[model samples]
Target: MDAILNLRENAARQGEKTLTRPTREEAEAAVRTLLLWAGENPDREGLLDTPKRVAKSYGELFSGYNESPEEVLGTTFEEVSGYNDPVLVKDIPFFSHCEHHMVPIIGKAHIAYLPDDRVVGLSKIGRLVDVFGRRLQTQESITAQIADAMDTILHPRGVAVMIEAEHLCMSMRGVKKQGSTTITTTFRGTYRDDANAQARFMTMIRLG
Candidate 1:
């Protein structure tokens, strides 16, 4: 609960000011250290530029750390008179790196919220996913993050978030099932307390 509150507060703080962190050269040097530690020659013909490439890739992959979904979600339109039904964005695919192993987590997210007055733009839903997805994450934290972000920014009556993903860490190492997927969900407000609302969200996401 405290963690989620911190995230919400952090989201609110975004767009207000910039936060400083490590430099790209420092990140590249770290990656090079990992290469050397992995017993790979960082100076080899093929690997000579690998660190720079990795640094650039890492910039793109974890860029979410520098962004806030609340900024993207801040815009809204209240033209939704008499249309207070739950708004849903389903089968939205995203790519995230697992914080546990720094490997890919390929997934689709299903997001829904029962509106109070206003609604956000459709693409903003995907943008919200990208904002959270570009950071290293666990499925559970990401689930709560999405729903919480929506609840905070949209001030909705309820919010629901479900993420289904295959973690490369699970598939490429450890027990290595190679095909298992993990699903996590978070619900808030009416979605958390209303069974009917929860079932409707599930049914809508599953619709053909």
Candidate 2:
């Protein structure tokens, strides 16, 4: 678990080398380029200020880059009074952008973990979901990331993350399959090894 923590921290530090901070003007210019590519007149009366607005919106939409889930889960209470059981947070609403099309993926995440000697704040679990959900991600990757975060940080006996979402890329275009939903799951430790524990998590979420 310590190695997992160090690996993620090192990865984040290494990832910084490939990134260059662009100025607001540069960001706005890129938006204008997209507008031109989309066949929209950037100088038109209706779209003149659109580039700046879109640039600002992107900052808000992808703010996850500035956050860390491990930090958010950093504070835990060991005074759980020997309550070493599964803690679950279900139907945590989140909105993410699909990396493939840069479109919306609306969903709910159901997260659970069996604590060892420490338990995190319940709201932190929901916030953990939001941190990852705010980034451009695939449903599969995000699900796995959440489970792994819990496993490494809380050192839980097990961790389970299930995400159910509808991607705008699929619903609004492509096959135009409306009402289509995608579900993904990741399990770690006991959740991965024990069938009954897994079944209990599933049943609890279904009842919710």
The candidate that achieves the highest TM-score relative to the unseen native structure: 2
Writing each residue's lDDT as its tens digit, candidate 1 over 159-189 gives 9999999999999999998889998988999
lDDT of 2 by residue, 1-208 (tens): 3334544665687884333467889989999999999998999999999988998898778777667887899999989888987888999999999999999999999998998998899999988888888788999989998988888888988998899999999999999999999999889999999999999999989993
- Model 1, residue 42: what's the lDDT? 92
How far in Å is the alpha carbon of 61 misplaced in model 2? Answer: 0.9
TM-score of each: 0.88, 0.90
Instruction: Write down the lDDT of every candidate, Cα atoms only.
Output: 0.88, 0.87
Task: Flag regions of model 2 displaced more than 4 Å.
Answer: 1-17
lDDT of 2: 0.87
Which candidate leads the pack in lDDT? 1
Q: How many clashes does each candidate structure show, in the order listed? A: 0, 0
